[model samples]
Target: MIVRPRPNWFRMLFVWRGSVLPVILPQLIGTTAFAILVTVLHGRVFAWKIPLNFVPFSLIGLTLAIFLGFRNSTSYARYWEARTLWGTLLNETRALVRQALTLADAPSDVPTLTARLIAFVHALRHQLRTTDAKADLERLLAPQDCARVQAARYKPAMLLLMAGEWLADRRRAGQVPPALVQAMEVPLGRLTEALGGCERIAGTPIPFTYSVIIHRTIYLYCVLLPFGLVDAIGPMTPVIVAFIAYTFFALEALSAEIEEPFGTEPNDLALDAMSAMIEATLREMMGEAQPQQPSGLPPGGFIQS
Candidate 1:
């Protein structure tokens, strides 16, 4: 996600990064051209003047804005929830690592499990984004664990199961106390819940039919807009229609971009940065030096992946 400090008012007006302008530019230009054509025709074709007025457009525009507002709100809600889940994941991972360090008697085993926890975070990030996690898993896990995770259909879930098994084995050997194991299980369960929540958001998007309806309505309104304004606004109709079209089209595009917060879009959640933060935090907790090059923040202080 684009992570630069907020720009000033002037810069904000011209800023391109993280704006929906790129995606909606073609549609806006087409709408503007249509508006210009309609205006040049004086809202007439073949000596037939279209019987349209601003009254209907004004009323419909109000309702369309409301609908767009509601849709944007819904999409933002999903984005916020996904970020909350990742925040929870980060916290729970740190908690799990701390618990293992303080409670487990096997010092060597603690590092292995901590590494697994780190691997689990990366795996979940890659899974949510549908990217390859083999390299990350290989780096973070032992050969056997890496092989098992790679072979599994769901790498994050598989890693979690392996962690549980390790705890159970430790408990069986009388290394980890029963109460500590139970304590550790709490975060593990929370991790699972977080993973499931992410999957739900990624899997179930805004309804397809609802999006189509909004899309069609917006385009219809924009295309018919110049005709409605030509009688009153004359040559100004194209400019007004284009402005209005930009607002609606940009809103629609923005909603679509943010609706799936796991993506690599400029406005999407910073999963790469988040995962890196989690890894750095966990590794620090384990008394390890930070990696020379962390993966979270890109060169421009943004997280793209």
Candidate 2:
């Protein structure tokens, strides 16, 4: 995600780093060229003139804008949910580490336990992004523990299971009282729920047919738009059509970018930064010094959303 102070109104118009303009620029240019061609042709096909008018385009534009709005809302819902899950992860991991430090009878084991927790956070991010977690796991876990988690197909779930086992071992050995063990399990269970939620979002995507229909509709509407407006606006068709096409094209592109929320896209959640944050927060709780870096989100406007 692009993280910086919001620019002033005039500069915002020219800002490109976090906007969908970069991805849709080609589409916008192509549509504008098509508009220019249609305007020059006077909306003609060889010897015959295409019968198209502004009234139908005006009506269609309104409905198409509404559909685009609805689709964007749906995509934003997924993006927001994914962020909420990660936020829960940060909170629960902090809570669990605090509990382990104060409640566990064996103080020396706290650091090791914290390492496993950190590893789990990194593992979840890698799992969601479909990246390798071997380096992170090796850094945070022992040879045996790392090997065990690496061998599992689902690294995050495997790490979560190990955490539950850690709590169980402490309870059985009389190092952690039964009541305290039950209390610690609350955060662990919340962590598990967050894990499950991330998995659900990663595995499920917006319906393919729905996206296809909307995408097809937007392009079709834009392509035929100039033909309808050339007679009404004359030479101004390309300019008007370019502006209108930009709106529709940008919206569709933005929706598609955020629909999967776990990607490496500019709008996707800052998983790498967030994972580092969890690590830094946990280390601080364990009396380790860590300098936290900023991983701020973009503005809430639809253009950036």
Candidate 3:
């Protein structure tokens, strides 16, 4: 959702400012304490210092770099998949409107089909990510269909079925021509595909084992970093460790947040706003007046259309 490219410094310190604190705090404390312990042990007791070798540190750093890269790449894949599914939704909505206009011209069927299209958009919004939405749905659906969909377990799928039923009814009434029915089916099939894509992204994830490995590796590296640096850096160990901790831990937490792009997280894709765009565009195609602008912009400055 955050598409604008910010400066690298702002990204490190402010882009994820609040979230980074929680993730990096414990690592910072541990690293600092370990550094102090190493310094004290070397000066007061051992009277000898341990030297850190750059070759091993470089190897570890390279490995960590690869791990972070893989994590980010995986997270971005999920984000982009969500974006693609919504894009398909947009194209399908437009196609559905064109099919309706070309195939059927009955005044009675027009309003019914129009309302159903709006209902479909609202239902998909609730269905994909959360269970807390029904307000917009209630506004778009008829009392009977709205009540029925509300009672059903899957609101979006129910609405899709409703659309199918409407199309079938119109076909029976000779309202929709055979050619138009076939064209309409194309968009409906795509709608189904989009639903499946969202569900897949929501249900499946990168293996838990891989996530565990990343976390463990980061923890171990942070913990061992103090041991490697304390003797050479002395009191500077804490500051250096904290910086390293911030870099690795923040990356880990951010990747974890982005891995699931449907939720209401700060960085997740803007599915709600995207669905609203679909609804608005479909409504316009139905010859309805546009919805009034809301007070605030969508979250994360992400415009759906």
Candidate 2 per-residue C-alpha lDDT over 1-305 given as tens digits, one digit per residue, 9 for 90 to 100:
76567899999999999899999999999999999999899999796899999898889888888888988999999999999988888889988888888878897778877888899999999998889999999988999999999999999999989988888888888999989988999999999999999999999988898789888989999999998999999999999999999988989999999999989898887787778778888888888887455545332211222
Q: Which 10 consecutive residues of model 1 have the lowest summed lDDT?
A: 296-305
Residue range 30-102, candidate 3, lDDT tens digits: 7667757766675343665455544666688789889888988999899888888888878887887777776
Model 2 earns a TM-score of 0.94
TM-score of each: 0.94, 0.94, 0.84
Clashing pairs in 3: none
**Candidate topping lDDT:** 1
Question: lDDT of candidate 2?
Answer: 0.87
User: What are the lDDT figures for the candidates, one per model?
Assistant: 0.88, 0.87, 0.74
User: Could you tell me the lDDT of residue 297 within candidate 2?
Assistant: 32
Please give the ranking of all candidate structures by lDDT, highest first, separated by commas.
1, 2, 3
Q: For residue 303, what is the lDDT in candidate 2?
A: 20
Where model 2 places Cα greater than 4 Å from the true spot, the runs are 291-305
